[model samples]
Target: MFFLPLVPINSTTTLGRQSQYPNSWDVVRHFGIRLSDCFVVTQFSADPRPTTASDALPAPRLIALDWGTTSCRAYLLGPDGLVIETRSNGKGILQLSADPATKDAEFAAELTRLCGDWIHEAPHLPLLACGMIGSNQGWAEAGYAPLPSRIMAKGPALTPVETRQGILHIAPGLVKDAGADDHGLPDVIRGEETQLRGILSGKESPASSIIVLPGTHTKWVLLDEDEVLDFTTSMTGELYSLLIHHSILGRHSIPPRHPDEAAFLRGVDVGIGTESQEEGRPGLLTALFSARSLAMTNDLTADAVQDYVSGLLIGSEVAGFTRRWVGRTSTQEPPRPSITICANPSLASRYKRAFLRLGIRVNTAADDTTAKGLWHTAVLSGLLAKEKA
Candidate 1:
């Protein structure tokens, strides 16, 4: 169910002029060792492998955990605020018992198994977690902090639990402006606030910017100074998965060893309405039908259909955003605020290319903003102090 890249996971990629390792390998082989040695990256840190622990290395005092729907990443941050080490497992909040009777003990047992070293070595270190792990189903009901909010604000409703290891603070998720979303209630975000905090750290802040985190549910957020203004969500990756696996296009959506740029770009243009016509090109859904029909007519190859549909979805996300938010198409060429995408390099590149096709420029932030955000917000929340010892 993961949104994996179209290329062979082991194959190298040549984007424009620069060549790069396979995306999976790039994340796995950092610090020149197996991912097991350093844990998973989730595209949050450039290299998960910690620098050699010299005699002067400060002792770790904080544990930053990015506990998502399917995985839990534990980061041990030294007093210098750098990652001392990381570990990950598949025991996300979804795997926990929702029943009050056993959930607490179950979570404690899971935490101990996953972070036994840290519990034993740094029992005093405070633990902070962001993502679904803070949701109602998680160990604690760390509720959402309402919007018009500071990204660094303390979880106004933290669910703190005292354990033998230390007190663990569950970072609260965010609730958008009431009725701002089509849902009539409000749109919500869990872990991205942390990543945004991390990406903006140390950089000269922009007065306003568009911050995008692309994945299963891509988040397009507006940053007005240091406060989060508003955001929209698009299920591009999730929809892609559904269509490719369950639709008629699924038969031809087999991934390739290497992608066909022509096919992908063609799909993007179609989705963005660049090559759309008045009669048959009704909308994205109708346009998508072309993938199957064109393939049946021998106009498109089966191998390229997947890339084409993918391009359509990604490009559609960009085009839809511009039209809905900016009120213009790439043809009219309205000035767009600089776009900053915080995501894996490969995923970011896809969005970058889609934007470039629309004559918009994109800036990329580090992939590991979740790690950064958690630490920054923790410091702001007074759970973690800023002083570097």
Candidate 2:
């Protein structure tokens, strides 16, 4: 429903970097895909005019939104892209009205409810959004962009919704090579792409790197020269949740939080296939059972099992990805990448530990990368110069 028929047009495009095109119609014609088809979307709007010298000047503040599956988050960003203030609507796409017809209206209403006061205060500030808010199931079906391409070269899929405040620009999600996936889970990322953009904005080299963004569904991205070379996804956090609380293996006491660093590292070792000595090492499913086995049998403490299990899952994700990408040995030997971890402090620490365990050097990205990323995309697309829609 969000495709919009690739019709002929004279209006502006939401796609950010492909500035040569006179309109979104021309932009799509040049690229052969809708911005949404190329990426995904939440929504946003621009002034529909070219950015001027003044528009290019550093802005005092802007709105950076990370609207995902579990929640809607807004950040009031300073000109340098640091967070000035934050607002959260503990609701995500899943929390919207179920009926399709009313969903669009709710998207507007919910965002207004979440950031209405801020919008009222700063009437013309551009609003940039990423994540599920742009999916087919979300406000608009801003298509998907294929991988091995410039992540921000093209702006976002412009899905603008009208409201009393202004237009909400839904960003696009990127889809991996359609031909590569035979079993059908073509790699795709919505919000992470924006976060990666934010990360690159701060770095000197546009050269490629192994950047990992950890979350409910963690993303491992290979960015090259401002392009998204490729990526993969793992349901690390979700798996931890299901295994530790929903499955039989999790049918034990779980404290709210615990230290248990030793047990966690041990779990990481197991996940990396180093902790086990048995000739026939157990698989993850079988290894998961040990959380309960050890707890019930007094091998793992009740307080430590949860963190240990978490370590195992995260460690496995990191190790598996490393083996596939970082460990590949070719005759020419590709240059070793500088692995950067972008996540909240806790998750970043876990991932950094995992990489270090295998001797991989890493750097942690600032926690505000997502917010800054929103800013970068907005500037690239000339959104800040525009008036409220």
TM for every model, in the order presented, reads 0.80, 0.77
User: Model 1 scores what on Cα lDDT?
Assistant: 0.71
lDDT of 1 by residue, 82-164 (tens): 66556766488778766679988878887888786666655667888888878777777788877677664443455787766
Score residue 368 of candidate 2 by CA lDDT. 70
lDDT of each: 0.71, 0.69
- Give the per-residue lDDT digits (tens) of candidate 2, residues 322-383: 77667632224433776889988988999888777776767898777777678777766667
In candidate 1, where is summed lDDT lowest over 10 consecutive residues?
8-17
lDDT of 1 at 127: 84
**Model 1 misplaced stretches (Cα beyond 4 Å):** 1-55, 98-101, 153-157, 178-185, 274-281, 331-336, 386-389
Deviation in angstroms for 241 in model 2? Answer: 0.5
Q: Superposing all C-alpha atoms, what RMSD in Å does each candidate have to the true structure?
A: 9.9, 13.8
Report how far residue 261 has shifted in candidate 1, in Å: 1.8
